[model samples]
Target: IVGLPESLHAEPLETTTVRLPRWVGGSYCWAGAYIAGELMRAEGFTDVRYVEADRSVDQSEWIARGETDFSVNFPPNQIASIDAGVPIKVLTGLHSGCLELIAKESIRSVTDLRGKRVGVDGFNNSRHMWLTLMSAYVGLDPVNDIQWVLTKDVKPTELFIQGKIDAFLGTPPQPQELRAKKIGHT
Candidate 1:
C-alpha cells in the first residue's frame, strides 16, 4: 500500500501519474489498474481517470466491491484475498529491495536502536519487516526491545517533524523530505 490520502481521488488519473508498490498480487492487484491507466495515457490516450487509494486494504476493498479496476500489492495479501474470494489478477513486480531502518539522530548502527520508539506505517508491512530484521540482527527482539508506533494515515515525514516518532522506516519522498528538513538522519 502506498498510504496516499483519500484526497487524491479528486485528481484525474493520467499519463503523468505513477503508482508505487513492491509488487503486484493478492488484494493489492487493483493498483495495477492505476499503472495501466498511466500507460494508456503514455500511449496517447487522454482524459483517463487517475486516482490513488489510501492503502492496499483500501484497494482490496475497492476491487471486491467492483469500484476499482486494478492495484499493486504483496503476494501474501493477494493470496489471502483470493482465498477469501475477491476476484483479482497479477500483472508484474514493479520494484524490489526491502525497507531501510532509519533513525532521527546519529545512531551510527542498528545496535543504537535499542529502546528507541520506531515508527512504521503498519504491522506486517515492508517497513515493519525491515525494522524487525534489523532489530533481530542486533540481537534485539522487535516486540520487546523497541516501542513500535504504527502511524497509518500520517506520513512518516510529518511524524518525524512533529517528533511523534523517534525513528521510522519509510520510502523515497518521505526519507528525502526528512533530509531536507533535517528532522532525521538515515
Candidate 2:
C-alpha cells in the first residue's frame, strides 16, 4: 500500500507489522523509514519493524532472521535480496527524482553557494550526491569549497529554519515550508 509517514490519514488500515526499504534508488537512502513507520501506525499495524538494509546483502540478513515480513528497498537492492535467496517483493514505487539544494538566503544562482555551508541529512545519500553534483556544476568543489554539515537527529528543513544551516539538500515541503514561513525564496 502507498503510505506517507508524515501524512494524516483518517481511516487506519488493519496491519500487524510494517517494514521499510533501506534505500529508494535516486531519491535518498533511509528517507522513507519514518514515513514507513507512520504508514504502519496509520494502517493500524501495531508491530512496526524498521529494517536497516541499504543494499541487498543487508536485506538478506533481515529476511534470514525473519525480522520483517516486508521491506521498502530499491529495485536493485530488492533484486539482490532475491538473488541472495531472500523472499521479498516490491509493493510499489514510493518516490522518484534526485534531491535539490536550497539556501536560506536568496542565492540568485548556484554560483553564490561557493564556500557556503551546505546541510546534508546523511553522507552518500541522494542529497549528498546532489550537493556534490550541484557544486561541480557551479564550479565549486564539494570537498573543498562547500562545507557539508551532516545532521543525524534534526531534519534539514528544521536546521534551515533555525538558521543553523545555510543550505539544505532534500526534497520538497521543506523548501515549500521555508517559502511559506518567508524564511527563504525558493
Candidate 3:
C-alpha cells in the first residue's frame, strides 16, 4: 500500500452521506459501518445520511459508482468489481465465518452439488460467485455441472422448502430459519 502524503491529515468533512444494507444476509458485516456512521454523526463531525440501496443494485456497483462510502461484502465479489475497473481498495479485514453452503441431507458434499439445482438470490451476486468457485474447486464446471436456479421471483428459503432447489448459499436469518424449522443441514 502506498502511504498518503503527510499533508493529507486535516479536519474531516462536516457533512457526509453513508450507505448500508437494509437486508439481513450481510447485516453482521454492516454493524461496523453503522456504528462508524452513527458515531460520526453523534460527534458533530458530519451530518450523515444513510441510504439503503434496493435489491436491484448490488453493493459492489454502489461502491464502484461512489454511491456508498463504505460497505462489507465478499472478497471475490469485490475483486471482480476491481478487475472490471471499479475503483476500490481493501482497507482492512473486518470479520469472517458468516457464509455457509447449506444443503439437503441427500447432498453430502460439494461434489454432490453436481447435477443439483442450486438457488441464489441473483445470477452474479456473491452467493452465485461463491457457489461457482466451490463448484470449480471440486472439479465441476459451474455452468454445465449444476443447474443454476435464480431466486429473483422467490426467496431461496421458500424455494428450498418447496423442493424447487436442492442446495443454496445462505447467511444469517435464512440459515437460522432453516435450522429452526429443520429444513436443511449445513
What are the clash counts of all predictions, listed in order? 12, 5, 0
Q: Which ranges in model 1 have alpha carbons more than 4 Å from their true place?
A: 1-35, 38-56, 74-89, 95-100, 109-112, 124-126, 129-140, 152-155, 158-164
- Tens digit per residue, CA lDDT, model 3, 1-186: 389643343656545555554445546667777787667665554456566665576577776676677666678777787888878886765436778888999998999998999998888777898889889998999999999999978889999999999999887888999999998999
Q: How much is 157 displaced in model 2, in angstroms?
A: 1.8
How would you encode candidate 1's per-residue C-alpha lDDT over 1-186 as one tens digit per residue? 389653344555555433332332323334455566666665555555544444556355566665555555545456556777878776654335434456767666787777877788888765576578778987988898888888889877777778787888766556666677676787
Ranking by lDDT: 3, 2, 1
How many clashes in candidate 1? 12
- Candidate 3 C-alpha error for residue 17, in Å: 8.0
What is the lDDT, from 0 to 100, of the residue 170 in candidate 3?
85
Model 2, total clashes: 5
For candidate 3, what is the TM-score?
0.76
Better TM-score candidate (1, 2): 1
TM-score for all models, in order of appearance: 0.52, 0.50, 0.76
Misplaced by over 4 Å in model 3 are 1-28, 38-44, 53-55, 93-95
The local distance difference test score of model 1 is 0.64
Q: After superposing candidate 2, which stretches have Cα over 4 Å from the reference?
A: 1-98
Top TM-score model? 3
Poorest lDDT segment (10 consecutive residues) of candidate 2: 20-29
In the predicted model 3, the residue pairs found to clash are none
Candidate rank order under TM-score: 3, 1, 2
